[model samples]
Target: MIFKRKSSATTWQEVLEGCLRRDTKAQRQLYERYANFAKNTCLRYAQNEVEAEEMASDGFLKVFDKIEKYDSTQPFEGWLKRIMINTAIDHYRRNSHKISWSDLDEASQVPYSDSYYKDEHLVNITADEIMMFVQRLPASYRAVFSLSVVEGYNHNEIAEMLGISESASRSNLSKAKAKLQSWISAYVIQQDEITHKHE
Candidate 1:
């Protein structure tokens, strides 16, 4: 039998209890509530939307399978987010053969610079535009960037998670930032030229 209830009518506690009991309706409700968040979290690690969707699905499956292990002391959202991130990392590992990691030595060759665009240039760029540029990054660089910048993981933690040395994590993040700066600089210049042409 299909269980039907308005989302507002069901408290999170109730949903959690139902989920613990393995109720399909409660599971559906949970997915409806957090699917976007899961997908968005995966998108940073995934190369594209299709991969993100796959990651999100795989993440939810892991969440449901492991819900019994969740500690009550911690926030459920944080727990769920961790699962999603781990799922992305697993995806990365499975496809590691396909992803080309920059040599640790080569990473040092990429020059670091100050912010490429002025504050005014940044004001003209949308967050979506910036995310698009991030999505265009290499898989290795994108994972390091998302884990470090977006997820607030330190190099030590990132190194443990990705199974690389701390220096490699730092190198990947540096290369990621350098590449993003170059892309953003070019984009800002293109936008300025287009604006001038229209004037």
Candidate 2:
């Protein structure tokens, strides 16, 4: 004889409980519900789709492995997001040494040029273009930028998470912004030249 769930409504709480019990269906459901969100978090820290997907998969495995330890009172999605971000950071730490580090003092002192790329120019750029520019950043800069700008984490929090000094976090973020500004300025100029040539 097969037993039926008393109610057809399978809330997220039920899904979490089921996942804790190692139910395959519940696990699949949970992954399906949050996969995009997890992948996007991975993408922000990843250089490409393959890396992002790998991080996302690893994050899900961690989520399943540690789901039982999750606090029921907290937001499940937020908890899951933190796991994904940590997974991405782990990937960064593993490969970070391969990349040369920038001078921390130079990065810290990289001045922002207000007239370089206006706010309106940035507003006009497509999200995909912005993401592409971010992906082009050096790995160290990318990690700090994603942590500081995308994830909205403060420098202290980012430093703790990435095992770097707070000053390093600030420096990396500053350099990333400078690089992105340069790219955006160049792109705007190129587009304008093309528009004028065609006119």
Q: In model 2, how large is the Cα lDDT of residue 66?
A: 99
lDDT of 1 by residue, 42-91 (tens): 99988888999999999999988888898978888899999999999999
Compute each candidate's TM-score over C-alphas: 0.89, 0.85
Top TM-score model: 1
Off by over 4 Å in 1: 1-8, 114-120
lDDT of each: 0.88, 0.87
Q: Cα deviation of 152 in candidate 1 (Å)? A: 1.6
Tens-digit lDDT track of model 2 for 13-74: 88998999999999999999998989888888888989899999999999999998899998
- Model 1 local distance difference test score: 0.88
